[model samples]
Target: MMTFNARALVPTIAGFRDEVLASRTACTAAFAAALHDTLAAKLDRAVAALHEEAETEMRLAAGKGTEDGDFLYEIYHTCTTFEHLWMESGPISILDEIYEDVVAEGETCRVGLDYTVIPTEQLGEIGGILDRIRRETGIEFIAARV
Candidate 1:
């Protein structure tokens, strides 16, 4: 089983947000750079594992080379292409959950952010979350898949 240490990035993300909100532009930029570094390292390790799996399958298929050679070749090509795109774009799916709290005849807004690095087949889940967030929060969010 593959595991990701997502907790390690929490502090970096929180610090970045805090610095940006504090109006410290340079510090915010630096923090963002640092966050990107962490993100890249984590993503690289995940992609490497995926590449290894794809290569292994490809090798097995090559040895067979009976009637599945073309299919296996196509599958291998697709996997590699997906890995390349992810590495180049650093794609992530982010969901912002917003809620309105009404108390003392006044309303306050609360927002929560959740995100994940989507695998190849789960791309639709990201879009679904964005749609739900917009409907629930009445806020239009622009999300990038990459």
Candidate 2:
């Protein structure tokens, strides 16, 4: 199993979050447009499609509301894309995760997560994300940061 010490990732995570948050206005504007176009019932699916387009998935986010769903959509904002910002709880969750990482000590920190757990096929999808982010914003992100 590949293990990461959260301390090493603090800057990267924070930097990533900073970049995401820095673009919050643009992301929210686009997300708000999408949200405006989508129906509440299909919001979860819409979010899923956004993840697909972004080529990344949100972990620990269980979409909750009138109907329960297989994919976690309750909490959001783990990923850098715009999908998470649509949910009310997303920004908070990201901030909370960052806070936990910043304060917690060895063996307690959970932010320095590894992606080997992500399936193989999805790796290619994620690679596309890296390419786009680099091509568009010049941010190295976690994949190429090292």
Model 2 stretches with alpha carbons more than 4 Å out:
1-3, 28-146
Per-model CA lDDT versus the true structure: 0.40, 0.33
**Candidate 1 on 33-142: residue-level lDDT in tens?**
44334333443544455555556655755756566776665555553443343333333323222222445557554333344333323433323433443353222333
Query: How many residue pairs clash in all the candidates, one count each?
Result: 0, 8
Pairs with backbone N, CA or C atoms under 3 Å apart (clashes), candidate 1: none
Most TM-score-accurate candidate: 1
**What would the per-residue lDDT of candidate 2 be over residues 52-140, giving only the tens digit for each residue?**
53333323223334354433333222343342333222212111122224344555543442222322234343334334444533332
Q: How many clashes (backbone atoms < 3 Å, residues ≥3 apart in a chain or on different chains) does model 2 have?
A: 8
Please report the candidate that would top lDDT against the real structure: 1
